[model samples]
Target: MRIGELAGQAGTTTRALRYYEAHGLVRPRRAANGYRDYDEAELRVVREIRALLATGFALDEIRPFVACLRAGNPSGDVCPDSVSVLRRKLAEVEAYIERLEAVRGQLREQLGGAR
Candidate 1:
């Protein structure tokens, strides 16, 4: 299918598909006129990429996992080092959430005081 059709099927924008291609995540063949032609396997890969991206995984962090999946590796957690990366990301997210909560608490207090 074309980029538009693939994007529609994957529930994402064509620009996002192009970004994935640019990142070496998804590679589609070019037609004679230089149009992209995505196969079903490529479409599946796009879906997987979208899922990983939604999980807050960095592109660099997700690359090895994608490779493991493509290689039919039995264990998805083959990258032991990724555990530390995930931990750091989790810590960052937790810190962000705490800061947001503190801001929200202050806003609530200010609103109560004004009332």
Candidate 2:
């Protein structure tokens, strides 16, 4: 498929696809006419990138997952690199949640005193 088709099927914009290409996240071949020629596998890669981005994963953090996918794994998370990234991100989120809970407690105390 072409870039437009991949973008459409992946529910993303062609510009974003180009950005992914520029960032080396997705690589496509060039046709004789210089149009980008994407393989079906690229669609799977695009979906994975979009899914990770939706979940607050940074593009750099997503590289391991992409590498895992490209390595012929059934899924991205099955690889050790991807698993390590998952663990790190989960820890970051957990720490953030703890900070937020602490702030919420402070806010409740402030409200109680103001009343």
Candidate 3:
């Protein structure tokens, strides 16, 4: 299929597809006339990339993981660096959850105090 068809199938715009290609996330074959020709596998990869982006993974962070994803299993044992990244992201998420919980508790307290 062409770029337009792939973009439509992936529920993204052509510009996004082009950006993904430029970023080395997805690669499409070029026709004799230099138009992009995307296959089903490319379509699947694009969808996966989109899903990852939705999850707050930076493009650089997703790049290594994308390789692991394509390889079926992420290669190598978890290094200290990888663990650190995971730990930091976890702390960030935990902090956000804690903040939300505090806000919820405050709301409940306010409601009770109002009554």
Candidate 4:
């Protein structure tokens, strides 16, 4: 398939696919006419990349998962590196939630005082 077909299949844009290729996330081969030619596997990789990005994963943060996928894992997050990334993101989310809760408490106290 070409870039447009892969983008459509992956529910992303050709520009995004290009960006992914530039970032080393997806590597589509160049066709005879210099067009990017993508395979079904690359389409799967793009879907995985988009899914991870939707979950707030940075491009660099998603590298381990991509690596895992490229390594032929059934799921990207099964590898140790991907697992470690998940753990780190989980901790960050937890800390962010704690901070937000603290801020919420302070806001509630301020509102009560204002009343």
- Candidate 2: give the clashing pairs: none
Measure candidate 3: CA RMSD: 3.8
TM-score of every candidate relative to the true structure? 0.64, 0.98, 0.69, 0.97
Q: Which regions of candidate 1 fall more than 4 Å away from where they truly are?
A: 1-5, 29-39, 73-84
TM-score of 2: 0.98
- lDDT (tens digit, per residue) of candidate 4 on 24-95: 999989989999998888987899999999999999999999999999999899999999999999999999
TM-score between model 3 and native: 0.69
Least well predicted 10-residue stretch by lDDT in candidate 2: 69-78
4-106 in candidate 1: lDDT tens per residue? 9999999899999999889988889999999999987777777777876898877876676656556665533466554566677789999999999999999
Itemize residue pairs with steric clashes in candidate 4. none
Local error of candidate 1 at 50, Å? 1.5
Q: Which structure is stronger by lDDT: 1 or 3?
A: 1
Per-residue error (Å), model 1, residue 65: 3.1
Best by TM-score: 2
Model 3 residue runs over 4 Å out of place are: 70-91
Evaluated at residue 112, the lDDT of candidate 2 is: 98
Candidate 2 per-residue lDDT over residues 1-115, each given as its tens digit: 9999999999999999999999999999999999999998899999999999999999999999999999998788899999999999999999999999999999999999998
- The ten-residue window of minimal lDDT in model 1 covers 73-82
Clashes of each: 0, 0, 0, 0
